[model samples]
Target: MSSSETRPDQPVITGATRLYAIVGDPIAQAKSPAVYNALLAAAGRNAVLVPWLLSTADFDAGLRGLLRAGNVDGLVFTYPHKQAALPFADVVHSRARQVGATNALRRRLDGRWEADMFDGVGLVRALEDVGTSPGGRTIWLVGAGGAGGAIAFALAEAGASQIHLTDVEADKATGIAVSVAKAFPGVIVSLAPPSLETVSILINATPVGLSDADGLPVALDDALPASLTVVDIVPREATRLLDLARASGCRTVGGAAMVAGQAAAVLDYFGETAA
Candidate 1:
């Protein structure tokens, strides 16, 4: 047998293969194609996930085009598309509804799109990997977009004691805080400026730290305590935030850990192996 056929993770596409796509405006940077394709292959699925560079203006109609494809099984969304993708789904799952966004969309056997957000679950898993848990931990979370909202809800569900939310747009922060607080009444969720005091964990959920020119999402006045854990969802392993968090004497979790944590959960939701 050929190496591609023998290797479980190597995809061997055929006419019977199922199709999937990860859509975003700048789809080139998306990691889902590589991540999801490998997961699908390892699950013994004859499927392939590809990147779709759909423009923001074209998102709604463009997505309709994708779903119309009979062979397309599902889609993964990133950036501007996550929030926009929610309305396209026939069923908006509780996870997506609570987060105000959807990151994964699967077509039902009945031919309807079902969607949910997994970014927060990914963060929760990432936190747990380093012996940290959101439960009973006070967190200062920066960012209130789709992913930000998702993270807030996930943290709340994981039993975070308190989640202090902030965003450049104050209302966005308030939206997530309100939704999460309402959904998880036991978890204290509120909008506030990022602060180090009393918070055991700090997370940068925004894109601010993704670029070299971007300023640090939160300005720490001094070194953090050993009790505090810092996480930045920017995919770069060497983001200045991570470096600063390490230099400032605290635990640091990078974006890859979050991706690794979410991969299996995402596949489970996508349901190739389980299906």
Candidate 2:
């Protein structure tokens, strides 16, 4: 027999293949499956990443059920589940622990779970990819949830001169500001209403512009200065904020850039790396 024929078969889906899943309430809208599956294929690994549409009411039960499945080796948490998945993890990395949220989880050899947050790192990398650094820049960030909290901490770590965090729930923004300040004492972090007056970069970390019907997160009467760099984490390459920013001549970064930046790290967490 030829050497190729002598080798074991490698089908797309097999009994021995490892499985990964992204969990969220509105799982259908997630863009992780395509990106991660492509990474898995490039890595020459017999693994697949799928989406799990889990509701809040069934989150705990549904997650436990997935853990029971022998083939499920990892999970990516989104939206309402990021913070909720914390208690289930046996160990949490420093970043996730500091942010009080996790976006990725992996099964350790000892049958325990290890979790980490990558949103902030991804955002910073995305900005860096476009030749912009948060260092010494004044930033206005909207939303203070899981992704926003991570991004806020990341901006500080990137040496941002000041970070003003805003959220519909004032307390949430304040809470994140406190955590970020404690972690990076040299970085000026505060809770403030979203404004672009003195900021070099403006970021939307909320779901404010996910659909056409959604309005802009920040109100603007005229074109913003071309010096401002706008970023949105809504997963769409042409989010409304990005579109408006581009129209106004501001340099813009979309959600896809962040996803791309984080893909390598996420694959590494799954014990897989793209070739």
Candidate 3:
């Protein structure tokens, strides 16, 4: 579909009606609809950012339908479905496979769905926005789950000298550390708790700040050096951890920056220039 075209009233779906969706469970919390829809509108695109709230049990059927839908321009995979969406892609980006997740899907010229993960790249872009490069920095990443794993790998690729991964499940954290170390053997890797010392950049990948979640992702009571750069992947306007970081005189980056970067990247995949 052309960017300027509008859908007909009570009309049939066709190849001309281009579509896009962000798949997740309990998708009501997602800001993708607001973020991407704004970008699409600014770019004068006919696309819409619809939410596909699919359960794990419904993943296969939902994905098949998306692939078969001729108007589906692309998709943004989120939350629990990041890993689940990997196998459906005809071409998986190397970074996505190594991180074991994907957040973007593009329709190839040959009519095959190609998958790519933008979380890590977006995280690095967010970090750079705060005036720090992951390269040559000692980093500590909390939460080795899907988002954490992607962020860790992205940090390694961006030149982090050493990365210490930590999670409630030590194995999950350490397992990712192993994969990252193998991917970049020159970088030091290990599992450990969050510490202000020796960490130039700290990332929180857990959902600790989300509504109805437990305490801060990290212990905020402890003193953090002013040299530390804190990045939290929580989209709230101002998270408690971010507040603490501000109070401690540390440079801070928000989840919204990551959201912005991802939205810009996804629009690029949709063959539209970001506004």
Candidate 1 lDDT trough over 10 residues, lowest sum: 1-10
Model 2, position 154, has a per-residue lDDT of: 92
Could you say which candidate leads in TM-score? 2
Task: For residues 1-275, write the lDDT of model 1, one tens digit per residue.
Answer: 23565544646889988887878766665565666767777778777888899999898888889989988877888777888899898998889988878888988878888998889989999899899988999999998998889998899889999999999899899878888888889988867664576889999988776677877886766567767799998877877788878888789998877776676777677774223
Candidate 1 contains a number of clashing pairs equal to 0
lDDT, candidate 3, 119-165, per-residue tens: 98889998998899998999988888778998999899999998989
Where model 2 places Cα greater than 4 Å from the true spot, the runs are: 1-11, 272-275
| lDDT (Cα) of model 3 | 0.82
Cα deviation in Å at residue 30, candidate 2?
Answer: 1.6
| TM-score of model 3 vs. true structure | 0.88
Q: Candidate 1: lDDT of 19?
A: 80
- lDDT of residue 12 for candidate 2: 77
Give the winner by lDDT: 2
Q: Model 1 TM-score?
A: 0.91
